[model samples]
Target chain A: MNIHAISAIYRFEMNRMWRTMGQSIVSPVISTSLYFIVFGAAIGQQMGAIDGVSYGAFLVPGLVMLSLLTQSVSNAAFGIYFPKFTGTIYEILSAPVSAFEIVLGYVGAAATKSLILGIIIMLTATLFVDLKIAHPFWMLFFLVLTAMTFSLLGFIIGIWADGFDQLQIVPLLIITPLTFLGGSFYSIKMLPEFWQTVTLANPVLYLVSGFRWSFYEISDVSPQISIAMILVFLGICTGIVYWIFKTGYRIKS
Target chain B: MTDNADILIDIKNITKKYDNGFTALDDVNLQIKKGEIIALLGPNGAGKTTLISTVCGIITPTSGTISVGGLDTIKDYRDTRKMIGLVPQELTTDAFETVFDTVSFTRGLFGKPRNPAVIEKILKDLSLWDKKDNKLRELSGGMKRRVLIAKALSHEPDILFLDEPTAGVDVELRKDMWNVMRKLSQTGVTIILTTHYIEEAEEMADRIGVISKGRILLVEQTSELMRKLGHKEMLIEISEPLSALPASLSDFDLTLSDDRKLITYSYNASHEHPGITRLLKALIDADIRTTDISTKQSSLEDIFVNLVRDAA
Candidate 1:
């Protein structure tokens, strides 16, 4: 619970992002802008508003959550993987620093990046469409809860991966596909009945819908259900990660 | 066990067994005194690495106890870990980190503050100040090894474990590393190193331990061990070559050279000494004149091979 170690790791990760400003912060903003233009603004002008809200408004929260999820997971995975691939994990293991400190350091930094990217993507979406937060409390709550959950997921993935190729497989095959299928581009209401029910099974749908619910006050699923699901997912992922560090499974052995 | 000083490390009956049914270390007991640099010498698969890793808490022992600075390694990991720094054999370092940040980050891992003065002294001592800003990836292999040493010393630990610190290293850098170790020893750092190079122990260590088959065969002071078991080899090359030894040569147990041009005799450790006058008179009685003779003292290699071969 000491903030000193957390602060040190967070600042170090932030500095790495700053060094790659184009890729980490700017590229995400540019990509989010394009999504708004093609999927929200341009498409909306042709097909009309979605669910009584402006197309840009409907896409805003999903865009922010998408960036938050990808960046948070990838950042944490790389942070832990680099240390291992380069053999610096030995240094961390030999040091007096505890496993809890390492987990906090890596996950805390991942959360910080996710938070920043989420905020920046939100602001950039404003360039394409006028936006307002209908429930300020819901917006802030989901933003943090969502970031922390994915960051923990990232820590687990990082520890599980041994090499660079192993690290890329999870994000590319699992996380990205889940995000797209989770209704980031279209609502489940636009799908057939069976397909809509299947879409409900996607965990990422809960995150995007929960965050979108905060912005537009309308969702295909209940906001409480998605929020509770996220917390449950967070608990499971944290348990797995804490167990890995405590047992020193692959990390130490 | 010498009780001349406080016990820095008290390792009792430690054992390790891998899942593959290979017992890497077994029931090993050792008492290391404060400020002593113990050289653990053994051949390949001798459990030297496993012993060091267990003491440093990198690998957990299946049984037994290890205490450093009077704190049990398993029960009090944090306290014991804080007092020790291990420089592993593999040259794995942060390639992207500059020399300064790498060591400073290691110091911070121990919860030490960013004292530029202390960091500067460590860098300068390791001869890394001029290369402080250079990234690890840019440095040569030897330089990277030096950086690892500097990082291990940054936190000012009481016990330092080096697993093969100089294997495959060039001669000049190896000497440089020994000099640095010497300086650290002068500062009262308890150093334990595992090496395949037996001469390293003869040159630097006060006490040498030979381990084999996951067991400590013997632990003794360098000179004491040598004096107790060492001997001289007397190789005499005669002026005359003979196909076979005469009956008078029976007084001396000797082996004929491959070409029958010389005779080799082990002069000690057999509880017997060959009388040179008797052998010379016997050779003269046989009308075989000796031209040259020389004797060489036994080396650590002789002692190591003798000890391990006997134990095996």
Candidate 2:
């Protein structure tokens, strides 16, 4: 309800990102661009088109999701984590702002940053491969939902992590590997039948599949199931965050 | 105003027990009047910070309740929180933020509407106006502390808690902070400060509370505490060196200096006459000539140290 507090935290966090533009915005854009150059050009030639769509264009949705997922989690996690590390969180804790407002500010800003990067990467994809979104509205929906969900996950990681190593552990060891294995560069159908079944178990697969479905109308899984899975994940993250605030976990005591 | 309402902060039997079974606070009770400057003095880990944190809603107490303006801190958190501003002990600020932005942001965090004149006055009062546009990372430590003060005051709360506000500060800044506090007190803002320096309390606090080992040992008016518990000592320099005290002077609590030329007497300052005349008469009767005599009153530091030492 305290919109001013939320906006203050949001602006402060956004300002930090602006000050570190090279690390926050530029690095991710350039890295995703490299994925385009290496995966789209070099690897796309080796593999033929799948589902009548060129390999390079097919890689666009996956690459954007890959960056979106990783950046969302890391950005939100680091957003809250840095304040905890520097002890500035006390100022927030002692203020009149509620815990929900605090989360909204940090998570909202992180999601916005990740969403912007996702869009820029999408635009940059046009330079390498001719891509089209069959459903632009669905594409935007998936982008915002995925950004918010992962940003919530990042907020959890930020609170749960006690050190810098722990903060980076989830994004690096878990999110990145899962995103890569979830069909960022290749489709699940390309794997053996048994591996394909196992690959479906990865939650990142649903996210990427649903996002890819928006671009080419083709996915490893049904789009409806992917949306349902993301909503469920979002609910779980919201519940955990509520419990954290109620118990004052890592923040109060 | 009603009685309870006049009591700005009513802390009743508040206790905080950490999960590990360590009791950080034990049945601490205090009532702070509006517009009175109180100093909570204690050693590190004496629960000074815990008590303040509990009252401020940063840490919840395991038992009992705290009410600000008759509103429970937990049940009515937002309302009570809006009434308080806390300047924490740690010097924490966003390194990339400019002073004006950070201070303005803190005001917004309190859900207060923007008032440029108020912000400008606070900045000017804290002597931070010149550095308003500079990033926090570029400011000196003292300036950062001032910014903390400005942020706390930005909301214009009725009560302010300053936790070791002058720790590690220079002498000039310390004096300057004291002056600022005095000026604020004149505006009827109730200030409660926790400090390691007894001199700070002596200089500013209208009332003093001593907390040690999770218990509030004493809370008394500054003048009343000094009058009731303070001891005065008289040092008498004798014309002739004596190896032993005279039998007539044995009734007085006295100590001979190491050189044997000085006799020192300790007594309560508020007592009627303090028996100094009788002691001097005894000295004369005993043929112990006293060339010179001077008296010194014990400071709040002495009272604090003795109280803490005895409590331990």
Candidate 3:
């Protein structure tokens, strides 16, 4: 199992996070807080309620999801990518650790960081809007699942990227825009019928909808479908990761 | 080449061909006995690093097999890797990591429990204990190289591979590194090093392997290799200048200087009778007076160049 190896890698990564606390913890917290002030306080006061909930409270889950997805992807991606860039990856590659343990260490640390950030953002939301949780267990479940899934995607991106520009391509170009359009600022129901159909195709919609349903019990799609979609995404990412280790993809050769 | 029981690492018919069809190693075979220092000497792009990397399990061989301590390197890599430590050629390290933390990190990566006492001894041995808390970036290149050695030794492996450990290092530090390697060898750690420095191989290696063009030309005991391949030259300074060599000297391999006052005779050192006495008698019978006579033997550098040139 090489449990010691996993613990070493995990602790090394977590130490890096603490060393760069401003960028890892402080920056995300401040940015999400600003989103709350601008979207939940200043703007929500002028908007009407949706699904019998205040507009500010409705934005909580979506906003937290938005940060969780981006942070998870970036954190895990950069964690692996920097080692490759610096040529320190040889130590990891030549070590006795297995591919599974390597992934567990890197992805686990990334998910933990995102999980902490998600909780902090949720706590920060209490300062701006009245929050409620109808299904606290499901909310925690969705939080953990979403963090782990995205962190796996981030680990893949880290191995796949060959340059700094490529590292940012997925998070900045794809994830951030998808989160914005995935019902972060408003409900997809407000869209015209045709647009609502198109929004359902966005994968981020499933994540946000599932998470919001756990909070307000109001969702654009059924909660079961959201869980299924996420689990399916998790399966796909796991398959790719397995293939990566087997084939010695960008990480090996 | 010894009894299988004494062999610690056995590499047989190993070849590594890259995707682009470049053969980095071609049918290489080697057997390293336990606690012996073997040095692979070659020039740049000679597959020295590739050979070491393959044995260390960093690169998979395109064909053939390697076994360390009777365990197949590919099938039992975890067990094999636990027995080997490699100090890579490049000085790649985390600039933000402290010396103590980085060395400890390598021990853990090898699945060993944390032993501050062991790390302390290694750091102190490498003269890095005083700088344990200093970041890697704050250290000089020599210090960083020592830290790399400390990391390799942190796990207390049975075998250590040093790839150009003294490349670009100063002479004094190179000698210092040699002393450290000698100390480790005394502790029964089987050491294999790849180097471009011929003197390093001659000075430290018990056996020297000359590799060229992805192939090993020969591996022999350092002293045996010198005696077998090395040639000797005798310079005879004449008491008076001459226009040409005497007819009696035609049987010998001789060359005359431009001034015609000095003659040089080249002979194979491996010969039981090098004809030095006969040459002196011939010179006396020819009535050629000599002012002085001295002999010089070829260095390992000369033999290495000739071997590589012949392989090319």
Candidate 4:
């Protein structure tokens, strides 16, 4: 198991978050706060309610999902990439730790950071809107599952990226656009049938829809389908990670 | 000086072929004894690092087997890795970590329990105790190299591999590193280091192994290698200038100086009878008066250059 190695890598990574606390933790909180102020206060007054819930309240889960997806990926990607960039990965590779332990250490710490940020964003959202949770347990479950899934995606990205620009490509280009179009600011039902079908194809929609269902019992997709989609995504990411370790892909060679 | 039973690492016919059809190692074989210092000498791209990396399990060989202390590197990877500590060629450390924290963390990475006293002693041995709390980014290049050594030793492994430990370090620090290595050797830690510096191998290693073009050229005891391959030169300074060598000296492979005043004779020191007495008698019989006589023994540098040049 090499628990000490896991904890060592975990503690080392977690300590880096404290060193860059402003960028890692605070920037997302402040950015999400601004989203709340602009979307919940300025725009919600004119937009009215969504599915019998206030527009401000409806935006909470979506906004949190937006930040959660991007932050988790970026945090995990940069976590692994920086080690490769600096050549410190050799130390880890030569250690007594196995590949699974290394992944658990890096992915676990990154998810923990993103989860903390997700909770903070949720708390900050309460300041701008009156939020409700119809399924608190499911809400927590979805929060953790999404963080872990996206963190694993970020880990894969970290290993695949050969340069700094590539590290930002997925989070900025793909994830941000998907989250924006994933029912973050509005319901997918408002779109035409064609666009609704297109929006449903975006993976982020499943996450936001499932999380919104937990909060208000109003969702673009069924809760069970969303959970199933996320679980599949989680499984795929885990399989890729396993393959990476088995082949000694970027970390070893 | 150890016996066969003391062999700590056994690498047999290990070969590494990269994905791009390049063979980095070809049928390499070596046996390292415990508690002895061995230096692997080769030019850049000679696969010195690759061989060490394979034994450390960082890079898997395409074929063959490697066992450390009788534990197969692949089947018992954790146990094998636990027995080794490597100070890689690259200068990499966590920029934000205090020296103490990083060293302590590396020990834990090897699954070692907390032992502050041992860490303190290693820091003190490397003269890094004063900077224990300083961030690694704040240290100089030499101090960072020492920190790498401290990290490698933190786990208290049975074998340590140092890849070019003194490449960029200054003379004083190199000497300090040598002292630390000497101290470690006294404690029965087997040391294998790869280096381009010939003098480092000469000064520190008990055995020297030369590799060129992915093949092991030779591995021999330091003193024995010197005696076997080393050539000695006898320079005879004539009291009077001679335009040509005397007929009696025609049997020797001798050369005259450009100024025509010195006769130099080269002979293998390992020869049963070096024929020094015969050369002196020949000089006397020829009535070549000499003002000075001196001999020079070849150094490890000369032997290394010759070996590499021949291989090329």
Candidate 5:
């Protein structure tokens, strides 16, 4: 609960993040731009506009979500996992640092990285296609909420992981695949009824739908439902994360 | 020691058992008087690390209790942790952090206000000031070990636990670490360490406790333990080769050494045994002759091994 400890850790972690500005900040920008080139410019010509938005414009929210989720996961994952890998966890664990301080420092840095990248991708999306913002406030809202949620998710993943291999398993294999299937690039309504129903099961669908609704003023799912789903998801993830910290699960023993 | 009422730690019958039912520690009881260094020594998997972890409140015990400074380790972790600094057996510091920032961050973790002078003194004592701006990965392993020490001491805890502080350390750095421990102890900081190397324990501990097979076999003053139970060895240089132990020399507990050119006898120094004269005469009667004899006194290792084996 001490703000000083948490701020100290947060500051140290921020310095560490800026040290890898190329990987943390620039790489996501480049990746989003490439999506515009290959998927937006090239593929949009054939696919035309799906639902009510251009193919290029349609992919923006998904790309933003993709970056936010992965960056949040990776930033938090590498942030925590490296100490354990390089044997520096002993320093952090043995100090007077509370579990809350450790979590705040790491998760706060991750949330910061996600927010910055989300904005960068948003600005980058505008250059490739005529991007619009129907609700800039909601867009910022979902962006910050989703970023914090996934940052907490990444915190859980980091503690659960013991080695580098463990750190990559959930993000690379699970999160990436879910994003692809969650209607990031294509609308579920375009699919057969059965596939559309299955796509509803993807938790990522709400994140992308909520974000897209903010920009286009229209989405396949209701904006209210999308917002609610994200909040619920955040609840589940926050519960898990704080519970892990309070009990001193993997971090302590 | 401050009146026993002010005992800094009270560890009562703590036991640790893993998932597979193997016990790492069992029925261990210890009280650490304020301002004392207690060394826990044992062979590998002898529960030394387990004991320290339990007291530090990092790992929960399967049974019993540990109270540090006055707070229970599990129930009152926040207050309890404030008074303890544990340098783990692992070198787990941030690889990309500068030495100054790492130690300073450690102080901040204890809710201490930013103090550059305190951080400077800690780094200076650890010889880390010169490398204050170097990333940890850029430093030598010895320097990294010093960082771990500095980070531990940065919080200025009343109690510090060093687990194998010199396990892979260089001799020079080992001596320096010893000096640091002495300085901290002089300031009335309680130090407890678990070490695989007995010599380090012999050099530093006021009292030594040997842990083996999930139990503390003996806890005694380092010197007193040796005086009471340590054994000695004497090597006899024989003029003639001996193929086997003599029939009448069974009382000597002897072994052939140097390809049978010498006979070595081990005996408890505290107990009455067959005199060296009787041993030499028995060797002569068996047509065994020795040119000279050399002797070696017992060390802490000998006493440690004997106690562990006896309990096992």
Candidate 6:
């Protein structure tokens, strides 16, 4: 199993995170705090409640998911990509560790970092709004699952990207915009009937809806469908990662 | 061929062809004995690094097989890789990592348990213990090269492959590295190195293998190769100048200097009888007075150039 090898890589990556704590931990925390101040304190007072939940509390799950998704992808992608750029990947490649262990180490570390950030953001939210959790177990479940799934996606992007610009393409252009439109600031039900139908097609909507349902028990879609969608996405990312290792994609040749 | 037990690495008919149809290695075959130091001498783009990379399992061979310690390199790579420690040609390192941490990390990567004692010994051997706490970027190029060596030796592998380990280092560091390699060899670690420095091969390798154009021309004991392919020249200074060579010395392969006071005779050193005595007698019979005589043998550099030139 090469457990030692996995832990070595894991510790190395975690150490890098600690070394860059300002960018890794503090930046996301500050950004989430600003979201609470601007959106929850400033804007929520001017808006009415939806589905019997306060507007400020309704934004909590969506905002946390927003940061979780972006952080997970960027953390994992940059972790693998920097090694390739610096030519240090040869050490890992020539070592006795297998592909699975390499992925486990890299993705596991990335998910852990995102999970920590997500929890911190949740704690920061308590300072701005009155938060509630109808299903605390499911809320934690959704957080861990979402972090892992997006981290795997980030790992794939890291292997696929050839340049630093490409590393930011997915997180900045795709994920951030999708999160804003995926019911982070408002409920999709508040939209007109036609727009509500279009919002359902956005994959981020499923993640935010499923995560929010665990908090307020009010969702745009059924809770079962959200779980199914997340599991399916996780499976797809796993399959792609397996194929990449098998084919020796950008990481190998 | 020796017994299988004595053969540590057996490479047979190995070829590596890149995707662009360039053949980096062509039907290469070699057998390295345990604890012997062999040098692969070649110029740039001669597949020296590719050969080392393939044996280290960094690059997959397009065809053929390699077995280390009787275990197939492809099928049993984990076991085989555990036995090899490679010091690569490039100076790739994490600038942010401290010397001690990077070396220890590599040991763990090879599945070795944490042994600060072993890491400390290697660092001290390479003269890197003083810089152990410094970030890699803070060290000089020579010191970074030493750190690379320390990392390679951290796992205490049975075989070590040094690919141009002294490429751009100063002469002092080069000599220091040679001494370290000698000590490792004394410890029964089989060492294989590829180098552009002919003197390095001549000074360190027990056997020298001349490779050119994706093929191995020959591999022979250093002393034996010198004797077999090396030539010798004898210079004879005459007591007086002459207009041309005397007909009596026409039977010998000789060339006279422009001043006509000196003559040179070239002969194969491998011959049992080089005709030196006969040539002296013939010179006496021809009534030519000799002032002084001296002989010079060819160096490994000369033989290497000729071999590579002929192969080309």
Using TM-score, give the best candidate's number: 3
Give every collision pair in model 6. none
Candidate 3 lDDT over residue span B9-51, tens digit each: 9999999998999999999999999999999999999999999
Better of 3 and 4 by lDDT: 3
Q: Estimate each model's TM-score.
A: 0.89, 0.91, 0.92, 0.91, 0.85, 0.91
Look at candidate 1 and give me any clashing residue pairs: none
Quick one: best DockQ, which candidate?
3
Look at candidate 2 and give me any clashing residue pairs: none
lDDT of 6 at A160: 95
Taking the tens digit of each residue's C-alpha lDDT, what string does model 3 give over A74-120? 99999999999988888888888889999999999999999999999
lDDT of the candidates, in the order given: 0.83, 0.90, 0.93, 0.91, 0.83, 0.91
Choose the strongest candidate by lDDT: 3
- Per-model interface RMSD values are 2.4, 1.0, 0.8, 1.0, 2.2, 0.9
Chain B TM-score list for all models:
0.81, 0.83, 0.85, 0.83, 0.78, 0.84
lDDT tens per residue, model 2, A1-253: 8888899899888988899999988998899889888888987888899899899999999999998999999999999999899988877888888889999999999999999999899889999999899989989988999999899999999999999999999999999999999988788999999999999899999988998999999999999998899899899989999999999889888
**Docking quality class, candidate 1:** acceptable
User: What TM-score does chain A of model 3 get?
Assistant: 0.99
> Model 6: residues >4 Å from true position, as ranges?
B233-278, B283-298
| Model 1 deviation from native, Cα RMSD in Å | 4.5
Q: Write the per-residue lDDT of candidate 5 for residues B87-117, one digit (tens) a residue.
A: 8887776777789888888888766778999
Q: Estimate the lDDT of model 4.
A: 0.91
Superposed model 4: Cα runs more than 4 Å off: B1-3, B233-278, B282-298
Which portion of correct inter-chain contacts appears in model 4? Answer: 0.72
How does model 3 fare in lDDT? Answer: 0.93
lDDT of 6 at A94: 81
Residue runs of model 3 more than 4 Å from their true location after superposition: B233-278, B286-297
Candidate 2 Cα deviation (angstroms), residue B216: 0.8
How far is A206's C-alpha from truth in model 3 (Å)? 0.5
